[model samples]
Target: MANLYKLDILSPQGNIFSGNVKQATIPTTSGLITILAGHTSLITMVSKGDIEIMLEDNSVKSFTVIDGFLEVSDNVVSIISDFAMKSDDINDEVIEKAKKYAAEQKQKNDNVPSEIAEKNLQKAIMALKVLEHNKLKRKKRVKY
Candidate 1:
């Protein structure tokens, strides 16, 4: 059996997830990082991407997170995100809206910071990727 540890994912809305997980892969500013039991303690800034957790039961859960901070200590992992949503919760309408808003923001030549537009675009793209990946995983499981 794999070692299990506590994982808590938090966002401004509320606690997104809290459970025991065998492993977790997070997107950091530098790159993607996978944490397991007994891993060394660390703290880093999370990037816009999918946070994948492998549960003790061997099932996987995925969440799309925007900018945030992640801390690992004493076998406990905590994620504080500005925004987060389960991949299954994302819908086409929301994705399309985000894309349109981002494009509109980018086209504006006013004082709007480009970072805002870029962040929106990144978030939309990341959500789509996570949704696609989850769909593929489900298909594979069905085939087996």
Candidate 2:
């Protein structure tokens, strides 16, 4: 049997995920780290990046998180993020719209463009990157 651990991810909106996972990879301020069934207790700041969760059945799930905190204790992992969403839930059309809005904001020639525009642009860029990476991963899986 594969070692399984508890994983719970929460965001301001609501609970994102809560279930058993074989392992999980998280992006922290120090970089990426993979936590297994018996990982030592840890508390770390989560950076904006991709988080991968592997289920006991070997299925993989991915999420993109903005900023958050992660804690691991007694085989349970908890994550609280300012923003988070499954990579599969990301919409390309939404990302493109964000980019276009940011560009329009910049074209306004405001010495310091709108903060909302910048944030939207950044999120859009990150989502796009994750999407691209997921595509590559899927392609690699198909080739094998």
Candidate 3:
């Protein structure tokens, strides 16, 4: 469709996704931004949050983006994230454990950098939020 655009999402681990999507909603440092096919060409820093992508078939896929940069140009979108993974691929238990670890370390008793500890906690929280959102979406589908 004319409204769809090519999207590429990548991280150090590997390419997360590459396909045509009807639209994409990303969380930036400023706020949430929704990009369509004809979005203005620009780049911005993405915050820790879920990236929701609506595919050409209207099905939605979500990924957790810890931090990154997003670019839009010529009807194509590119996202390069420091850390990212599919919602389904993430383990909530592991994230929760990380959150606890960060919280414990945040006390400054272990002499760990508070910034790093805080960042880890924030990432774990964001990942959990994305996982929760995905679970709710799946539940809604089952009700239909």
Candidate 4:
């Protein structure tokens, strides 16, 4: 069996996940980084993308996280993000709403701050990507 390490994911709303995981793939500013047991202690900035975790039972779970920071020390990984949500939590309704809002924001790009509009659009796009990835995973799991 693979060694497990503690992983805690947090957001302004509060703790999103806290438990042991065999492996974790985080979206860092540099790019996606995979951490296993006994990884070097370090800290880095996180980007907007999906976070994939391999649980003790080997089940894979995923979440979408916005800008944040990650710290790894003593076999414990902690992530603090502005926002995050489980893949399963992002349903079709939420995706549609985000898409509509993003389009509306883009249409008013001239009136709204470019940076804010861009950030909103990026977040909405990230959410959609996460949802699509989850759907593909589900499809692969369905045996004929």
Clashes of each: 0, 0, 0, 0
lDDT of each: 0.88, 0.88, 0.87, 0.89
Q: Mark the regions of model 4 whose C-alpha exceeds 4 Å error after superposition.
A: 103-111
How well is each residue in 1-144 modelled by candidate 1, as lDDT tens digits?
559999999988899999999999999999999999988899999988888999988898888898999999999999999789888888787788888888888787657787887788887897778768878988998999
TM-score of each: 0.82, 0.82, 0.82, 0.85
lDDT of 4 by residue, 1-144 (tens): 559999999998888999999999999999899999999999999998889999998898998998999999999999999878888899888878877887898786578888777777777888888888888878988954
Residue pairs in clash, model 1: none
lDDT of 2 at 34: 95
RMSD of each: 2.4, 2.7, 2.5, 2.2
Worst 10 residues of 3 by lDDT: 106-115
**Residue clash pairs of candidate 4:** none
Q: Which prediction has the highest TM-score against the true structure?
A: 4
lDDT of 4: 0.89
Model 1 alpha-carbon miss at residue 12, Å: 1.1
Per-residue lDDT tens digits for candidate 3, residues 42-76, read 89999888889999889888888888999999998
